[model samples]
Target chain A: MPRTNRQWSLARTPRGRLTTDDLALVESPIPQIGPNEILVRNTWLSIDPSIRIRLSSTTPLGYLPPIRPGEPLVGLALGTVIDTRNPDFAVGDLVSHIFGFRDYAVIGTRADTIGGYGLPTRIDTRGMPPQWYLGPLGSSGLTAYAALTEVLQLRQEDTVWVSAAAGGVGAIAAQIAKLRGATVLGSAGRADKVEFLRQELGIAAFDYHDPTLHESLAELAPDGIDAYFDNVGGDHLAAAMDNLRPRGRIAVCGAVSGYDGAPHSGNPDLFQIVSKELRIQGFRAGSYNHLEGSMRQEVGGYLTAGDMVYHETIFDDLTQAPTALLAMLAGKTIGKTLCRLTSE
Target chain B: MPRTNRQWSLARTPRGRLTTDDLALVESPIPQIGPNEILVRNTWLSIDPSIRIRLSSTTPLGYLPPIRPGEPLVGLALGTVIDTRNPDFAVGDLVSHIFGFRDYAVIGTRADTIGGYGLPTRIDTRGMPPQWYLGPLGSSGLTAYAALTEVLQLRQEDTVWVSAAAGGVGAIAAQIAKLRGATVLGSAGRADKVEFLRQELGIAAFDYHDPTLHESLAELAPDGIDAYFDNVGGDHLAAAMDNLRPRGRIAVCGAVSGYDGAPHSGNPDLFQIVSKELRIQGFRAGSYNHLEGSMRQEVGGYLTAGDMVYHETIFDDLTQAPTALLAMLAGKTIGKTLCRLTSE
Candidate 1:
């Protein structure tokens, strides 16, 4: 092991747009672990736009702890156990934890060293890409899965629409709703993303830039949607509200459109809420933390059966995480953005 | 019984504000009843903001059939059965039904005379003011009761806020939430209305015109609220979203703010719907139609026990329905607005 661990610490809390200057890469003495400890060497780190909510001084509501300044940022990452003093963990065991954003981390007894989300869990690659553990079998995928079953309570007859359809959580949400025997519709920003949604995911997908989303949605689902899984907020949400049928359900799992500290735009036609008897609610991935085991198993089964697919855009090293996150916040990334610490 | 039935029919759907000119007072010979029929002489008629939705040519999205031009405008009213051939009804039985805005209605065989909701059920006044049935035990009361118990799911420790707290549904909603052991707060438009909310309803109340609702909400519920029952949907809704805690619930029963047919103004602060993990869903009183019996029983129990109270603003005679409805929608009336057709 090297004498130092390289990590990105919050240089200054961001204002408006997130820039690379918001984070500072620094060298620190390798953390020393106590009894019942394991050391991890991170291989891949996930960069999600939700991380921006934490970078703000006023923590976004819900249950997640705020990201503090002058501290290493926390995120999901797949890693290898390099050393262990704990009987529960063995050297060379593949694992995943919120101990990412650093090349190496000490796992126990030091308050800042270990992951807040319990112990690092062993990862089963299932002969698929290991990075899938950070996606389809991880927090983002669990979010889509739990939201469909618990929040939306999607039925086989439901006609569902997914906004931000090509994004990580939206991709899984669109696919899962389809697998549940729903008639699915999806909206993506770019033509290629719309193509990916239609060709790969096999859903009727449209680009949001073409005219108004409300008109396209009316043409696509003439009867109206039974449910909506919203990843992008604003006008896409407003359009869905306008078209949602009576007793419709919405699982607002993400609001990537408002992550830039901008006030939420688009005055939604809310009168339809009463007139249509619609139910719109917001939920966080962490709320489904207990169902992760079942979510992972179910989502993993579909991935192996070829009924599901996912995409990843990789940053070569941890140093590029800030840049990757910025690209995602700017709506440039089509799918999951990952920081690859080491090559396969 | 009178030889002629006088009713208020729609003249032309008003484009903006509803005026008496939009309604035509006409007389038709009372129709003869069929084998299974009843004739009702209306004594009271309800004037609700929701009535405006029906008068529009473009039907509001829910299941309620739109009011046709040149047809008697439909509403809820208390009446006495003047004649009956059906075993289900008896002559002179006090009843309530959605067969109002008229005097002398031939209620069987003809589709237009009978209430679209259902047959007139005999009113069980429970010894309180008989008119309390329309305010606290009728649809307005049902709206508040079901919204608190089923929609908001009020817990013992919850802090609740009721918008339009002096209005029909809002008045009952404020009382019911308080009975459920939740600390209650309300917002009304006028000083007198605010005083009514505080003294008569016995809840912490504020005037909406007081500089900013958001600041007042923060001051009222410093820790944040667990539930909100909204009758007004503009800035009041925006303020509620700003103050609700995580896992908060909202039951959007009415949007009186948009009753004027004006474009919905004041863009609501909706990002909090995501940040707060809020569940904001819209519902109608009729959606809880089946639960009316239980709601009546529960609400009646409170009224009899003096644990709950209600108010009514009466407009005498059917001719004043248009005037009454216009007044209620204009925010002039507090509590239930009823047009009295006859003395008990």
Candidate 2:
């Protein structure tokens, strides 16, 4: 086993736009495990936009505190147990936890969870891609499922719009809603992503940048949308409000537009909430972790039938993790963005 | 019966800050009632903020069409049916209908309802003040009751904030929540209204104009509020988001700040909705008219037992309906604002 561990750490809080110098790859001796502890060698890292909220010096109230400079960045990861002192885990066991951006993690039975999820649970890959635990059959899948079923209460008669359709959660949400027989419309920031949504996912897709967003949406749904899966906030949210029917619903999964260094525009005409009698609910998948089993069952069925398209933009090795995050944040990556670490 | 009827009409859509000239008190002949119709002499006019939305040249999509110049304004009014050609009504029957801003109204069996509420219905006043059917025992009361019970789903353990607490809906909402055993905080625009909220309504009260809204709210609810009843939107909503706890809820009843000709501020930090896992719902009381029976039962019990204080800012005669609306909009009036028309 390697004696040294390489981990990504925040060098400084990012300003308007993130730069390479803002992050550092730090080296240290592998952390020793105590009784009831398991040492994991991470094989995959999930690069999510929400972590950007912690890279700043301040976070929104009630959210996790900011990740200070020189501190290791924490996220969802899939790893193998290399050394185990806990009876529940054995060497070679594949597990998922909330200690990522690193080569190795020393986990205890009481490891921290992200909003009640990612509790260092064992994963049985059953010969399928083990990395799938960190993607579609995991948190991303559950997020989409919970938002659609619980928050938006999506119905078959509903015409729903999924924003940021090229991203991790949006892609699954758009496909799942369509699979449930709802008329779905998807929006992405780039032409290629839009094409992927139309051809690969087979949904009505649009580039949010084309003309005005409201006009693009109006051209597609003149009668107005019944529900919205919002992955991007700001203008996207405003546009969704402009096009939603009376008694419309919105499930806010992420706000990628505001998480970056860009200044908040605060442009949404919230009065739409009153006029249209709209319902807007913001949620984190971790809050609904109980739905994970049902999520895996359905998503796994789609994968086995080859009816679902699970795409990934993977960065090679630990050194590329920062680049992967930047690419995802700039809307340059499609589907789930991840870092593949070569386990020795 | 009087041969002439005086009605309030829109002379021109107000540009910014409505003035007396924007509305005109015009004279018209009282129309003869036909079969299935009733001629009512109006006694009370309910001056509400939502009417300002229709006075503009354009309204929010999905809302009722704007009232044009020379068109008579419509609102909820209490009147006595002096002449009836319909079997469902009789002479001297006290009733409530959407035909205010006039001294006399000819109501058809197919009279319009507001958002599915406000249908012309007979009121048994039962020896109570007949005008209470226009104030606490009517639409304003129903609005507050529906917002608290249905929209907010208020709990006894919750600490909720009601904005515009001295106004028609706010006053009732604040008291109803307080009477239900929830810790309530009330906010009003003026110092006198603040005093009324504290001394009369018997709740923790603050002037929204004092210090900063966030500071004032934080001072009272340092731990954080669980639900918010939003009557004045814009900055008030921003403050609520800043001070709400995780899983917080907001019921959007009105946006008095936006309804006037003033430019919208659009200053609320919507990202709070995501990070804090907030739930926001906008509704009109008309949608929950089914709950009106239960609402009147509980609210009426409060009134009979001297547990509720119903305040009214009354203006004599139909000529002051415009002034009453302006006063309510400017936050110059307390509780329910009404125009007491002297019926001939």
Candidate 3:
């Protein structure tokens, strides 16, 4: 006899507003493992705004495939393996996989099994909580790492400005730039988040909703900024353009500010790019899957040495997953938002 | 005894239209040559749009001191050496120097001459007209070369888009990209200029005042543009962004479209830069002073071999210099707008 499993499936396509009815809790029979497959009991599920694009029928960028109706909402998640047929992965070993929004999943053992970097599996969450793997030391941390190191090639003497500084990716990117001896400045929506960046992360400076954002930045960085890690677009980018030094680099990691609206309107004045010689680049974390080994080793060392810190907004049940995602979309959550499945 | 010489001095600042009264023709004694200096009779004076910046009290970006009222307006000009005290330069030799708008000039003989790029005192106008040195094989050609070769890193298989296609820099840059094996496309304001680009340069495609500029470009380059040499900014940049491939490179050479207007209103939408991962870089031809020797050899050889061609809208007398500049500012000139001091 096999065990039963519960998974969240996309019930319908979202038109305007997403409702709980868009997702349905369904029962599924436990899948049998193949010779190279492993059975994982997922403990945590990550909810990200990028999932909204996957839910749409068509996207302008055309990066990822659209999710089908009645199919599991697939994304990145943290899980622990209970059974494995592959010789490399032993039973009881904790792992992270690109599995679905399901409690238990039977995934084929491939080179991408460990950190998705084709590296050997060596996951040891010693004193820190396992959930940190999905937030800072995981996909979000890698995004910040690749955007700063590979894309922007940030220098030690450079000044870095990060938008959406309280979010999962921005928070880690600011800290990483700080760790590399850069003067770090950040922007957040609320006063508390601004205070959090200064008081908690020891960020050099932070601001919230200043109407003269460009002038404020010019005052802060009299010499001008060397690089910008943009998570929130729109006015933040416009302000950044005014403050960027000649030959400055901008890493376009996300545009959460105008994700729901048309991208044409509310764009920044780009004529300065000609006079200033600015470089704006967009990057997805998956494109850097090859660097996951060294990235994990470096970020994991930072975690163990108490050099990096991360926060998670946790939801208790799977049914609350929709609400958690909505909160993130509405900018109501402070950090990485995840749902903990109790029935696993 | 040396003859008395006349020079054009900046008399007053212009709010809109510039008049001959704005410049005063004053007579002064011809200058005496120093140990490292040479005396030359000015033969041809070059008039460019960049001179407008010198007339303003505030200097433009990447430029030196503004032209003070009551001082002579200065720029690059070709002349015949009448006397020389330096061993490197000889009498009766034709030379180019950054002399004031005067009939005779005394310039110091440094390794690099009066031209900002410190070019050597060698002459190589074999078979081609000497005036061609003032346009294509001079600063204009060097600007196009540096922006395309260094900044954009123009690749052979790329699709290149050049704005202001009939202007001095744009016309040459389009040819250079085409020579590098790129599929070249361009935009000109007038139908005649558009036909000139199509018939004369053999560009892949062209457009003129089309409201559907973005759609037209998308249709022309279905695979997306790989590089953009921007001479005109504003809506052209926005259209380029719409058609740029992921990781496309842009050389921001000039913003002639919005140079006369305020910054924000005439600027293009820059938010697409994030999605496209565009590298928009500004370059001053003066920055690549070291490459002048090799660039002159290369571009000069192309001109001599009949592999390259250029057109100039020549004004007959020194008095017409101001009108010629005004015509260039109004986008009325087809090719390089130059003032021929006297008939050859």
Candidate 4:
């Protein structure tokens, strides 16, 4: 058992692009578990793009507040309960919580669940891989499910476009949309990712960097798409608006194009929204935690039936978590970006 | 009556700012009504902002096609039937149709209703001012009513903000929203229009030019607004997004800011939409023609009970239709902009 805990903390608010020097991995004495508190040895951390928003000097309105310098970064992680004063949780139980980017976390029963990274919950992996909970059977899966079902109300006959279709939530969205029989067109920044979406995911895909985004989208969906699953904003969102059919629906899950110190491309011809009577809705995963059980059931079934393709770009240990995030944001990672803290 | 019919035609596709030189009123012989056709001597013409979009070389997708040079312009008009070859219509009957910017119209049975401008329908004015059919009781009224009821689903607890609040649709939307028991705030560009909204319309109003739009909106609605009725897009839309509370709703009726030659102001922090979980729906009055009866019942009741304030900026004679459009687009008009062609 480790006697000390090492956690990643923000050394400064990043100005443009983030760097390793901006993050500090500091070792400290393991925290003591108080009454009703649980000590968790975090084994896996989920590296997501939304955290980049919090690293700025001020986060967007209604979002989680910015993480100040020297504050440990918070994220979703899977851990084993090493010690527990809480009656409900037992030692050796694998749990999921929002105290990640660290080797150990001290959790309380009454921890805040504002972003739906709720209190630690025990996972019943059901003989499946435990890391799957951090990917398709967890927040990523729920985001895709809620967006397609609740927001988009995707119909089988509809043709839908998914931007950044090689990313975590988007990949799941593309597959689930196809499983429900919608014609899916996926777009990615890189040629390799576009190939993956075409050959591996079996979805009509395009490289957004080729020619013009409008022309690329036009080629894939000559009749215009019925719905759009937006993971990249800026030019991608503008293209979707231009190519969407009348009365089209758009589900905005993320706007990663502007997350890495780049200004969001504006002038999206908002008149398109009025002219086409388009409906745009922006959502986050925390709001859809209610659908987690059903997501796990359906997605887990897909995994068991070999009908789903789950991919991961995982770093070896906690020290590489920052590298994993930079790689993912740079569009180098293939699928869900994860940091494996232990070989357990 | 008159043997010659004076009709407004597009002289050229507008380059930037629309000028009187862009429009030419040409006199032509009145056409005879054919079988299943009715001849209407237009009495009042509604000069709306949407016409500016048609004057451009190309319109937004799903919108009415652009009117080319030498083509007569079209709009909503109130007229009296002078001759009828159809059994359903009788001479001297009052009618409303989409054949404005002209002194006379020959309406056929199969006229397209793509934008919900159906074939000519006789309007029973019920002793109300017949011109009211073009203002509070017509397309403008229906637009406000549908936005509040259908898209916003306005609640009594909602604090709603209406942009371009002194314009035809915005004024109606602001009043209707207030009548539905919601706290309403209005914004206009000019001081007099702001005064009209505040003192005459009895709503909390602000001048968008005073201070920054965000500061002005924040001064009016400090906590946050629950709903936004957007008529002028660009900065107003961005401000609303910035000031909307979580789960806020925005009903986009028009984007007049972009309809003119000026480019739409962009870089609205779209992340705010996701953080606040905002739902934005763009709609047109044509889509909500079904609610006309209910709108007439409610708004007509308000006007009859002396609880509604209806104002008009009238341009005399058919020649002033171009001036009326320019004034309306430049925010020089208060309430509905109209061209009164006849004394009757």
Best by DockQ: 2
Question: What lDDT does each candidate get?
Answer: 0.83, 0.90, 0.74, 0.90
Candidate 3 Cα errors over 4 Å, as ranges: A1-40, A52-58, A65-72, A81-95, A99-130, A261-267, B1-41, B44-74, B80-128, B261-271
The TM-score, computed over Cα atoms with residue i paired to residue i, of candidate 1 is 0.92
Worst 10 residues of 4 chain B by lDDT: B111-120
Q: Supply candidate 2's per-residue lDDT for B152.
A: 94
Error of 1 at A126 (Å): 5.8
For all predictions, the C-alpha RMSD in Å is 3.0, 1.4, 4.5, 1.8
lDDT digits (tens) for residues B223-298 of candidate 3: 8898888887677776777678877878877777655433423344454555555667777787776777777787
Write the residue-wise lDDT of candidate 4 on A146-171 in tens digits. Answer: 99999999999999999989998889
Residue A94 Cα positional deviation in candidate 3, in Å, after optimal superposition: 4.4
Cα misplacement distance, residue A225 of candidate 4 (Å): 1.5
Local accuracy of candidate 1 as per-residue lDDT tens digits, B1-344: 56888898989988898888889999999888889888898888888888788888876676467788898887887888888988888997888877788897766644443223566778866566666777888888888988998888898899999999999889998988888888999998889999999899999999888967978888898999889898888777777777788889999987788777866657666667766679988887766878888988888888788888778899987777888898888888989898888643
Give the per-residue lDDT of model 3 (tens digit) for A1-67: 3388778888988776566777888898888898988888887888777777566565444245577
Error of 3 at B306 (Å): 2.1
For residue A309, model 3's alpha carbon misses the true position, in angstroms, by: 2.7
Residue-level lDDT for B161 in candidate 4: 96
Each candidate's fnat: 0.74, 0.82, 0.44, 0.85
Q: What are the candidates' individual DockQ scores?
A: 0.61, 0.82, 0.39, 0.76
